[model samples]
Target chain A: MYVSMRKLIQLATVAFATLVAGASLAADKGLTFGMLMVGPYNDHGWSQSHYEGGQYVEKKMPGSKMIYIDKVNPADRPGLTIPMVVDDLVEKGATVIVGNSDDMKDGMREAAQMHPDIKFIHISGDDVLTGKAPANLSNLMGRMVYGKMMSGYVAALSSKTGKIGYLGPLINEETRRLAVASYLGARYAWTEVLKKPLADLKFQVSWIGFWFNIPGVTADPTQVARNFFDTGYDVVLSGIDTVEATTVAEQMRKEGADVYSVPQDYIGSCETAPASCLGVPYYNWGPDYVKLFSAMQTGNWKPTWTWSGPDWTDINNPDSSAIGFVKGSALNAENAASLDQFIQGLGDGSISLFSGPLNLQDGSVYLKAGETASDKQIWYLEQLLEGMDGASK
Target chain B: MRMQGLKRHLFEIGLILGMVVLFTTLLLSLVGASPLEAFSHLFAGSLGSWAKFSRVLNVWIPLTLCSIGLLYAFRTGLWNIGVEGQVVMGAIGATAVLRLGLEASHPLFYLLAALLMGMAFAALWALFAGWLKVRGGVHEIFAGLGLNFVAMGFVLWVIFGPWKRDGIASMSGTQPFPLELWFPSLPGWRVSPFALGLTLAIILLTAWVLYRSRIGLNLDAVGRNPRAVRLFGLSPSRYMLLAIMVSGALAGLAGGLQVTGIYHRLIPSISSGYGYLGLLVVMLANFRLAPVPFIALFFAALNVGSIQLPMMMQLDSSLAGVIQGACVLSALLVFGLRTLRKRGPSDE
Candidate 1:
């Protein structure tokens, strides 16, 4: 037994040596980028997709290197942080720093200040100086409402009971406004197309004050999904990590319920609940990243709070959204034909998701008769719409 | 210390066991967990999955190093809690160096800088406590704990102040170091060869020092009875100071390596309570350095596995903490019970 162990050790050492040698041979043009995640890279939500986007960048830019750090707490945003892990990136020669979370304000700022030559780009951020490019730092975000509208389309199309549920994480401006766009689309489909009363189109909404599942105390989304399905809501539309929504649909199917699901993070959830899942409004953050970096390389970079969102289209368009809506297989041929026409109409400016005269669940006037909410009004949503079951408070 | 040394073998085992159980109950009461379920949760979390096992190891590597360093305190009877602060300092030191441009050299530079700076920072932190103990009337425990808070504050300040990034203005953090500077990943795991080496090296070194040196004997004497050291012509006060410093230094080394080799930067959320956890390891080991690695790893697994509870059991991670407290308390209970039995039987 001892002899076998020795032999095994020897073999392992040789293999390790060979692996190192192979890696060394393959090490060429080793450019590195930094990805800061607020949660574990494995978290199947926002963090996971961002991580995958980093992988996508690596696959596209063969010689470039990508490094990710997860679970970066807020207090670590400043300098004394033993957890910030930014200095390590600077040490590793990262030419471009990708700050993934909103809280990385301090850590990345210090890094950019200290290393002025390195290009710094912030996503889902608001601090980048507009018009005047500061040699190195820039910020990028996208029109989330555009994608939410597409999700709204799915929600509108899928509601059999004429009642749709919107599960939101952290009821902030981003979510509130997005929810409104989604509601408008659903209302448009139910009222204008199907001629159903706006009152019949119930929008059940709830806020969990978090991005992902927190062990206890908060509502377990899967349980909530099951409860929703058990209570007769058939088509579940998810505005958060679509994984939980799809998982719930899968459970319903197992229990023999005819449930259909639409999830975000378009690709994976579709695969997980293909039969029930309609494609989610998925974002492709990579193209923007590439654009930012290429502009940086050419010394012609501008820093602005840029919001890129266009009509639902193919992946390769310049102004194309980071999010894409996957067409559902369950969408009937008649509905599918209509959905396609609506999709085109959305892009060409004929069909508006928010054709007003809208009312909140409480019968409060949201948009008076002959009034459609403009872009500015949509961007700053304050309260929950009518027919929503949960407290917006 | 053989089991046979006790006049009654089963009696001693039972006593130690009884203490452990009682202590476990105490821990449960502190956190309001059903004592029985907590231990079960802990056990399940530790042995659950490959992912959980990996998390424990990740936790263990740094914690074991800290505890092994802390053995120096037990040697001289100094209850040093400053290892936590010292670690933050070392990690900060390593981060500062890496940030400044130390990463451009071979990975060895970053590794070496982290190790040396970590030890230096810990030693400095310890020396501060030693200075206080030697100068003021302050006890080593208070001084050590004070240092921990100060060091944590310092870490927070850096991440938020000078280390702040120009991003979302949210509390996220700076991006991680470049891949080249990262301690290479073990296939299918988060383990770093550098962390593994440091943990093992500290373990071996601590064991060797404690088991094979004249200094070790001096430390043992100081611990058992400080007055005895004076009788043996050794300065007890001096030894106390040295022990605290060594303990602090070890914690610093852990902190340094954790940043440079593991997390790869000085983030504000770095400590993860390894210093306090080290106390549990030392206590669980009965102050024996050699067994500390195993115990720390076990507890680390418990923590990592608890994160899984959310994924699998839909349970909270705090449940894991509840279990850990129970295990410690129960073991202590068993210890107390055995001692009670020995004394009572004689009285009866």
Candidate 2:
């Protein structure tokens, strides 16, 4: 028995040595892009949108392949850092890597410094703007504020109750700005469009602490949505990355409650509960990904922060738009017509909700009369607007 | 007689290995993957180059430390399931010190101080569990498990509250420490040499303390028969507390290294489940110290290599965890069979 065990060990050692030699002999042959996703690729929300964008890249560019690892967050893949995965991807001959999470800012920066030759695209980061990123790294995000505004517009148009709830993710500049944008749209629809008294409308925001639920880590979105519905908030605009708002709305409607939801992120999010979904403000990353990858391939890529907005000529044009909203089955004909008019006004610059006499949640002056918010002001919004309820910091 | 004992040991090991391979291969085939290709990918992904091997070493370092720590607690017959909480407290303590030294000079001094504070914190946490067991008569397992939840809650609160970034309340953790505060490594190396040296020193010290000293004998006696140990003028409770504190110190050191060496910030999961993995490693080593490091290296390699499964084969990386579970189950089965054979069916 002892002799056989010794022989077995020797044989295993030789096999492993040969395998190592074989691995080194293999070489890269094509343009490979590596994608790291914070959630599962099939999650039908944030990560899936990025995964589909990678798939779009493969179809558009010949001889290019995508290698992706999803669920890249610390909770799901503990002990796996961005640099470690980047090392593996580089070994596999990837020239471009996309990290699809704001949580990856530090690790992506570290990995970008480690591999200056490889180009890195970190979505929803300000590293490039902040001058903290290396020259090889860039940032990309859709102007989702417009989409969220449209989402709020539709929700306010279709609601029977004037109370609207915003189911928010963690408190950050990005989420804060988005939530505020939704509130602006809802307020516009409630007062100017519907001719309702300003005191009759109620808007509140509830944050669940993270991008998505991790069981015990984040508050369950389903429960939060149910609370919104049970409390006479007839419409809930989801600022999270999942379809839990629509799903809960559908469950509530079945029990004879009239509630509507607008899910965020991927276009197909409403398919989970189409009857209750008012619309989805989704990201169309394909066109931007193709443009960026083409620039990288032609060696004309300069690291820049790109916050692309939807094509005004056709917001839902899959071939052109970076951000788009799709109306769900629940939107009534009159509300849908009004929503189209609202979109037209936004596209033509005839309406600007950010112009005011605006006060922050603390009643401090945010914008004076006839004063408009600049891009920086909108991007770094410090508090929820007056008449909104939620934690700001 | 010595030759027969060695042969039996070899036979038991072979049986365990064979069972693990068979079970894993069956799982691969069931998933419609070629077993040979999967095995090769796992091996090549982990050991294909120096860079990859260094990553495996990075995982092995902490895992081995925790396993060695577990050895001390096990010697005194304490479950010490609270090792996970101890690791978190250690990370919290290390981060507290590192945060203070963010702008301080002589980063090396701060780094050393952080490690010692981490150890002190973890030792105190472990001592609480020991106290509950020795004085309050609460089972260490329950005390440890409950404390683990509290530790988790505390880390979450720290990340989302006081340590949050300027305007960000995120689970991504505090802003990273400066590069100077990071555990120094060579230009091309992924693992810090200082961490490697410290781990090696700890292993040697543990071996001496657990095998070559009078304290080792007393702890072993306490484990086997605490009442008898008291008759020998040795306080079993004292030895139990001492063993648990030492275990906590080592686990804490692992957490400290994870911060200064690996993560550079206090992420919510800074411990990376290494504490539980250590429990498995020590158990699979059959409560012995000799095989602990080897088993830890194997587990670490599996962890590092499993990344290849997702990238190359579109297979779930959890297969590595499944393989690990199979190995431990197979070891338990082999040991059970050996005991059954020794008793010649009369025990049944």
Candidate 3:
């Protein structure tokens, strides 16, 4: 028995040595980037866009691999923290790590401080601009306000009841600004394009307190959407990270309601309910990710807050555009043409909805007459604009 | 005879381990993964290097603390289902103290004060349940479960209202405390030695308190026969409340450590479900204090290592939970079989 134990010990030592050698060999191969997604990879919304962007990076840069772990939220994977997962990714030979959520701000900041040698990219975070990020940490986000404007424009064009509902996720600066942008576009379409009085149009926002449903935690997005359709609202624009608004609109349409919905974030969000989808204002993160990853690979990367805008030459160009609006099959030709005009006006700087005479919900002047708001003013919009219904704080 | 008993005990443990391995292997094969690769990945992910092992220890700290606390309640035949809420309250209490001491001179004093406040708050929360059970005759399970929901709602309100970050109300939770308020750890160490040392000392104290003292005997007597314990002039209700309060105090300490040592902030999921996971650990340890620490360590290793399954094999990390469940079921089966063998055919 003692001789057999010694033989087993010898065999284990040989196996361990072989495993270590193989691991070291694998480590020398290529550049591996790690992605931490806040939702499932195939959620067909925000997280899916980021996941596909990672895929794009692998295809664009040869010998560069992408390793990702999704559903990195506390509700999904309890007891797991950002720094803990970052350590695992680094151990797997990932030189650059991307965290794709604003909710990951503190954790990413902590992890960035912990690993000064590795590059960290936090999406939709202001840490870099706020001067709170380490030298190795950068922030990346698309100018989604423009996309939300298009969504509101289309929702207004498609609405029969002249009432539009916004399905907002949480009441932060990002959600508030996006919701306001959508309302501005809708009001512009109602007053300027359709030649209707502003008072006849009803624009309201309902926040679910999170990007997605957490059952007992957040207010259910599905129920919130149904409540919108059950009321006189003929159009609902989803500002959350999921397709619940579109799905609910489809279900309500089947019940013979003349309702339409516009989903946000992913390019393919319209596919969930094509007949009811007016259009989707999606973030095409591929071009931005490729640019950043390439810079990191070539060692020319510097930490900067990138808020990329769409390529006006061709908004749907996958290689150039950071944001695009895909017109759904439900959009009539006449309205679609008008929508194209609105897009052209936006692209050429002919339309600037943020120019004000704008008042906040509390009757405070946000911008003086003929005064175009600065980037900081727009980015840190504290309250909903007047004529929009929602809790600002 | 003693040697034979020891041999039988070892055999039962071996049988349980074999069943767990067989069950997990079957599960991996059903998912089209190589069982050997999966097992090796699990081992390497948890115990590969010092960094990984330190993370596992971080998980083990709270888990073992909760498990040891559950032992006190279990000894008195109390089902402390409110341990989860108690942990949350403890975190809230700690955060309250830490928030006040954000700019204080001595960080260590505030840290100690925060942990004590955490323990005090959790003990009060547990005592309310005990009071309802002893006085109002409400079942402890129902009261505990109801309080869990209340605690959840209370935490959400606190996070989104009074404790929210300036100009931001989010589920991401309150603003993170500054690094100065963080529980100090040694360089290159993820797990705080102070937290680890405290947990070890608590475990030793609990073992002594529950097994080697008169209070321990009285608690056991109360659990076994409350009516007969009255002859000893001891109040069973008081003992019950005392046991649960002690249990809450320790669970609260776990929460305090999670805030100060791990998160350094009051997040919505501060407990990380360690309270519930501790229940599982205590159950799998067969409600024995001696095996509680080891079982918690194993579970913690599984929780930490399962991240590799998703990264390497494209498998959901819930497989770790499945393995945990299988081990508990297999141990129960072996335990049943052992009892049957000892009873003989005539006993039935």
The TM-score obtained by model 2 is: 0.93
Grade the docking of candidate 2.
Answer: acceptable
User: What are the per-residue Cα lDDT tens digits for candidate 2 across A204-301?
Assistant: 99998888887767789999989999999999999887778888998888788899999988989888786798988899988898888878876798
lDDT (Cα, tens digit) per residue for candidate 2, span B211-307: 9999898899999999998888999999999999999998898999999999999988888999999998897677878889988998899888888
What is the TM-score, restricted to chain A, for candidate 2?
Answer: 0.91
| Interface RMSD of every predicted model, in angstroms | 10.6, 1.2, 1.4
The local lDDT score (0 to 100) that residue A244 gets in candidate 3 is: 95
Task: Judge the docking of candidate 3 as incorrect, acceptable, medium or high.
Answer: medium
Candidates sorted on DockQ, descending: 3, 2, 1
The iRMS of model 2 comes to 1.2
Ten contiguous residues with the weakest lDDT in model 3 chain B: B5-14
* iRMSD, model 3, in Å: 1.4
Query: Chain B of model 1: TM-score?
Result: 0.83
CA deviation > 4 Å runs, candidate 1 = A1-31, A39-45, A59-62, A70-83, A103-115, A129-136, A311-321, A354-376, B1-271, B284-348
